[model samples]
Target chain A: MKFLKLSMSATAFAAAMAASTSAMAEEYKMVILQSLTGGAAFIGKNVADGAAMAADELNANGFFGEGNSLVYEVADDATDRTQTLSLITRLAADEDVLIVMGPTSGSVALAGANVANEREFPVITTTNSMEVIENGPWSFILTQPADVTIPYIADFTAQTLGAKNCAIIGVKDNEAYVALQRKYEDLIQAQGVNLASVDGVALADSDFSALATKIATSEQDCVFIGTPAAQGANLVIQLRQAGLDPSIPILGHNAFASPTFIEKGGAAVENVYLMGAWVPGGYDDFSSAFSTNFEAKTGIPADEWHAVGYSGMQVIANAIKDAVAAGAVTREGVRDALGTQTDIPVVMGEGTYSYDEHRVPHFGMKVLQVKDGAFAVVGE
Target chain B: MLSQQILNGLVTGSVYALFSLGFTLIFGVQKLLNFAHGATFMAGAFIAYYCTISGLPFLLAIGFSMVATGVIAILVDLIAFRSLRKRGNAEFPALVSSIGVDLILVSIAQQVSKTQVLNFPFGTFPVKFYTFMGLRISLLQLVILATVAVLVALLIFYLKKTTFGRQVRAVATNERAAALLGVNAQSVYLQTFFIAGALAGLAGVLIGLLFNSMQFLMGEPYMLRAFVVVVIGGLGSVPGAIVASLMLGVMQSLTVAYLPSGLTDAIIFALLFVVLLIRPNGLFGDANAVAGGTRQ
Candidate 1:
């Protein structure tokens, strides 16, 4: 009887050891493909912060599949298109990565999207451009489309704020701004607003004194600046300095939502209108929670890019959970699950999501005003 | 529209002149294009930003930035150009080395600063406006114009009146002859680089203050504009560079105002093409200047 008891004890110990080994073997890995170096690094670092935070949350909450925990791998593309393609290709081929997340710029996102489609790996893009979502059902945009945001600015300036005469200043030959200019011009004219002037400034333009002078002389009640935060803020400050203030409302597109805009524009930024997908200080509980947690984790206030990155990871994480629940780890299963998602809570400044047939989640936008150097959501 | 265009041209032209003066000096003395010159300008702007943000006085920040950039220029020559010169490498090889240095410096600057645009403190200077004949000009423009004028006059006086200036001219004309005539060509080259770099550094600070934002890649546009001015004004000619810079700036401003902004650069390039056709040696090239004359 003693010998039999001892044998049973040994067998039980072996069984426990096997269970531990199997659990360790089932650890799931994910790759964050992004540009973490070079000029885009500041924005990319924030994106990385959001992605990492989501990964940590999932791991801590045991939100992964029944047999799987999560591990993250980061690949820096350095904002190079060719490097991004190569990196995505290698990451997709890695049998360990259950999913892949970024490649921040719109152009890089488009490239990664093509590779993800072939490999059947899911990619969630944080970029605002629509071209990344045009071709594939596997791809998702965490940010609202520029088309949606740009027109919203136009409508806000025209019908809502009642600015009849508007001048548009955009970056010359920039694909994103050029696309936005077309949409904005069409939308503004449809609202019966007189498009006083559409001025194109070169991307390398350093001085706005000339543009400001022209705007001061023109019969416009508002000016819409479609450029990055740096150029936009510079234009605003110069316009104000040139004595064109209190005469026209300076409305900015999504670019103005960046913290750099506030830091650069300072006091001049007050009363400037900006259209964005999410505003941090608002009633959105999910965004509030995410912002607080993000700041705690990264030790940096969350920016728009961070919010988008977090949302991208959330979308992927949700789809991963749904896929595992359905006992389908294949790419087709993940794609189907992501496509059918409805009202999934996004951690972005914009809450909730609804995906169309293309599996692209549509998160609408809101307009925010810069008051006392912070963003406040104006009434819709 | 015409007045606005001209005003734009003048502001842009002033910046161009600032950039080309450095380029002309380096080209005149060293007989090297110094592709890394743009990186020097970019670095200077970033250093200026760092200083201003760190609570250094604005004027002190400008001076420190220039001095720091001058040191970097000396280092560039010592590490990259001096070695090539010592080895007696072909001019093409030296040019290629400069390009390599350019890449390294640009990469380092971008890595350190990232891509964010940093703004100088507002109200650092008064934003007064002056009107002449119904054309409004900002205090910033007047400052830039005055600064460039003083710098150009100083450069001219230095070249014509100072012993070091004569040594630079002698080395530029013939390094071997200057070396034989008790002039240290290497030292002359070093001084030229220092002066040129300091000028670029000053331009960077001026541009950052005037534009209200500075980026790591800001130097590329100025570099291109300076190149165009140098080609049009006649290479190695300081006075010629100033004239060409102002002309190009006015041309760009006028084009942006009168024509669509998209066509402004195209118009400028077209004008360059016309100038090249009319005078292949450039507008201010000497009588003995040869077409496609190689820098010695």
Candidate 2:
């Protein structure tokens, strides 16, 4: 009778252990997908930072709810499309991650969208291009589209600045610049401002004296520069050297909104207007908090890309919280929660999120001008 | 528009001439197309920039850069090319060996200077405007043109008048015969490379100043253009290289100013193709010379 009683206890203990182990296995796993290495590291590092911070904040605050310990996994895509897809597949199948954030570049994000859609994992792309969300269902962009930023710039330049004629200069053979130039030209024309001329310069060409001279001699009131920081900085210096006054007003695309632009352009970049998704120095709380924490953590200035990255992470964390609250911790459930997200308070400062029509954020941009060698919010 | 384009071409063509003359001289004397020529040019620019940045006077920097490049060229020949000659390798093997040296030198440069464009600290050289009838030219272009002309004239005088230059010409024409006549062909070859490297180095310093940006990879573009100039100008002819450089530069400039930028490179290549079709051995090529044997 004693032996039977002992056997009954042993059986009960084994059953209880099995039940608890099975329950533990059902907990949600999150993956932070990013390009940690390569040419895009400048942007990728920030995105990774933002996601990690959000994860840390969420976990520490018990945002995943009581008794639900979230497991976070980070994967490097190396800014390669093939590797990005491979990483997504591995993370989805092996880790069984319910949600993911980023595959940084717009082009890489587009490729990641297809895999995310197939696996039912919601991926919040941090790139600003509209192409990321045009076809994918499980993808949502955290950055504002060119269409929104371009139109805003047109109105700002025409009405606020009272610019009558503008010259548009874009980098030759770059598809992104080509698309931006087309939108800019259309918007400028729509604003009743004369589109004086459109010039295409090669990326490697340092001699912009000829182009600058032509622009100076033209009837244009302002010049719109659409190139990366390196070429753009060179053009600005050359333009001024060739006797084109900075007082005439120079407007640039979002490409000119990086710290590299300021660092490279130096004093020459002063008084230039840039229309970007986030207003640098405008997000008082976010900027201050990020600067203090980021400098302490990484010993580097948290540029605009870092802000976008942090915002992307916040969005993902919110969706994860909503997913768990609704009792849908699976990939499909997390994706559904992210898809239904509305007005997520991102670090980019209070942006609305809607993937109803497409997986794109319809965030408005703030105009910032380089004043006294630093970006400051102008009359918006 | 056409005239402006031609002027642009002339400037570029002058650069091509400077590059090709060095390449042809090396090929003619050594029978080896020194692929490391580009690296020598790159080294020259780096040395010049380093010297200038370190507070050396501008002229001294140029002189130091040239001398440094010439020394490096001789070292390259001794360490890399000398082994192949000692081993009695075929012409192809010697050429291949030079390419290996080129790879090593280029990699060393790339590692030393991370792959970013270093801007040369060029304040404006005195700017003067010269008007010739309806055409206007800048002082910078005039300086470049005058320098090239003077260098070419000096090169011709040295080759015709100097005993060492005559020995160089003799070795280039017939290495075996020159050596049999106690002309010290090896020394002639070494001196030829030294002079050729100095010219290439000077060109690099000039180009770096002109573009205001110097990178490790900058040499490749000029090297390729030099090859085209050499092919079109006729191999082993310094005068031919100069003439072809001018023509090529004019063609490129015209294409850039008038035609769509996309078509510019295509048009330049098309002109090169036309030249090849008309004169397979090049404009100044010897009538009886075997095709593809000029360098050998």
True contacts kept of each: 0.49, 0.08
Model 1 stretches astray by more than 4 angstroms: A1-25, A36-46, A60-62, A65-69, A118-121, A202-204, A280-285, A292-300, A330-333, B286-296
Best by TM-score, which number?
Answer: 1
lDDT of 2 by residue, B36-55 (tens): 88888888888898888788
Q: Candidate 2 — which residues are off by over 4 angstroms?
A: A1-129, A132-144, A162-165, A213-219, A243-248, A259-270, A278-285, A288-357, A361-364, A371-376, B1-117, B120-208, B214-228, B234-237, B248-250, B283-296
The candidate that wins on DockQ is 1
lDDT of each: 0.75, 0.71
Model 2: per-residue lDDT, tens digit, A1-380?
Answer: 99999999999999998888667643567777776654454456567776687667667776766545567777777778899998888776864677777787656878898888787667777666667676566776766666766876777888899998898888775444666777888887888889877778755455554466556556778999987655676778656654676579998877676665666566777898887665544365755676567657765555566667766666677777787778876677777777677777665534544444555566566677888888777873
What would the per-residue lDDT of candidate 1 be over residues B54-79, giving only the tens digit for each residue?
Answer: 99988898899999988888887887
Error of 2 at B124 (Å): 8.6
